[model samples]
Target: MAAALLGGGDYELQVSLSEALCRLTPRKDREQRTNQWFSSRDVSRAFCDIQDRDFEVDCRHFLNYVNRCHGDQRRVHTFPCLRAFLDSTELFPPKDEKLEKFWVDFNQTSECLSFFTDDPQVPSLT
Candidate 1:
């Protein structure tokens, strides 16, 4: 995250990771176990690919954002990369552990699409 930015990791990858961050986030107790498991797996995979030197730092940054936004329905600004995403999406229906929305906004709507996939031929975490 912030510290990793200093290491000059792949920008697009970080952006995608940020996007995956949003997608993988679960809707708390209300979130479906199946979806959570799948999304977690996908997110973890992408996260793991980051350089080992930066993984721990980035993970800490990502988790900090998550923790900062905890209990926040909108979950806005959970990551630095989320700013652009937030502006492009619809502003309604704040997301929560009970509501999973990815289309409308980072954490506002529960319509997240599967992102990272192990195989191109296979569908992602849906």
Candidate 2:
């Protein structure tokens, strides 16, 4: 699956786990960030096992569905489909106000591709 995504050439959407988390977290909470929040292996397995052509379309639909929910910032984390691509931390529990900021920033960002800047050292999705 990684090969497919990498070979697709439109993989600009694929950002590393760390890169995604770093944008949602502040420097002080950096120590709490762990790569184990969500497993890439699980994502690869789930994505590969699915036999649907409209997965991306379904995802967009789900996003819109969740966007209208009350307390969507915390509610967004409970779904399994989005979990496949997103990496999150338990350090900031659902009750933590910071978690709201994290999800808000994540949603506002360009599909979590913050590393696509003028810098030459672009991070890879691992």
Candidate 3:
């Protein structure tokens, strides 16, 4: 995914996580004010802000981090059909609210090549 996103130098949108957060928050003015550049600490801070304080999405702690709510597992469970799998995260929400923003941003991103849909708790038979 990272390779594909960065592989093509043709990016339609170039914004940082914080800036995206700001825009989602209805603060586009602030988004333009901040620089797009991010340091390691900034990345860490953004990750922490998105995840539960106790959770960390890093290589070292990732296994334990998503133990309860795995992205891959959620995709499979929530999106059994190919369309659902590729279409939404309603079937696979983060464990909490902080994670929701991350999911929303992810779904809205062209890079992820996914979409946002009303994710009913239970997958539909139809």
| Tens digit of per-residue lDDT, candidate 2, span 1-126 | 333222221222322322343445554543333223323443323333322344333332323232333253322222212222224521221233222222221323233322111222345567
Runs of candidate 3 with Cα error greater than 4 angstroms are: 1-39, 53-112, 119-126
Give the lDDT of residue 98 in candidate 2: 20
Could you tell me every candidate's TM-score relative to the true structure? 0.21, 0.20, 0.20
Top lDDT: which candidate number?
Answer: 1
Q: Against the true structure, what is every candidate's RMSD?
A: 15.5, 19.0, 14.9
True-structure lDDT of candidate 1: 0.36
Order candidates by lDDT, high to low.
1, 3, 2
Runs with alpha carbons beyond 4 Å of true place in candidate 1? 1-64, 76-110, 120-126
Give the alpha carbon lDDT tens digit for every residue of 27-121 in model 1.
Answer: 34223432433345443443444333454345444443333433443332233322223355423332233223222113323323212212233
Which pairs in model 1 have colliding backbones? 1-58, 27-97, 28-97, 100-110, 101-109, 101-110, 101-111
Name the better of 2 and 3 by lDDT: 3
Model 2 misplaced stretches (Cα beyond 4 Å): 1-51, 71-126
Candidate 2, residue 57: Cα displacement in angstroms equals 0.8
lDDT of every predicted structure (CA atoms): 0.36, 0.30, 0.31
True lDDT of residue 74, candidate 3:
25
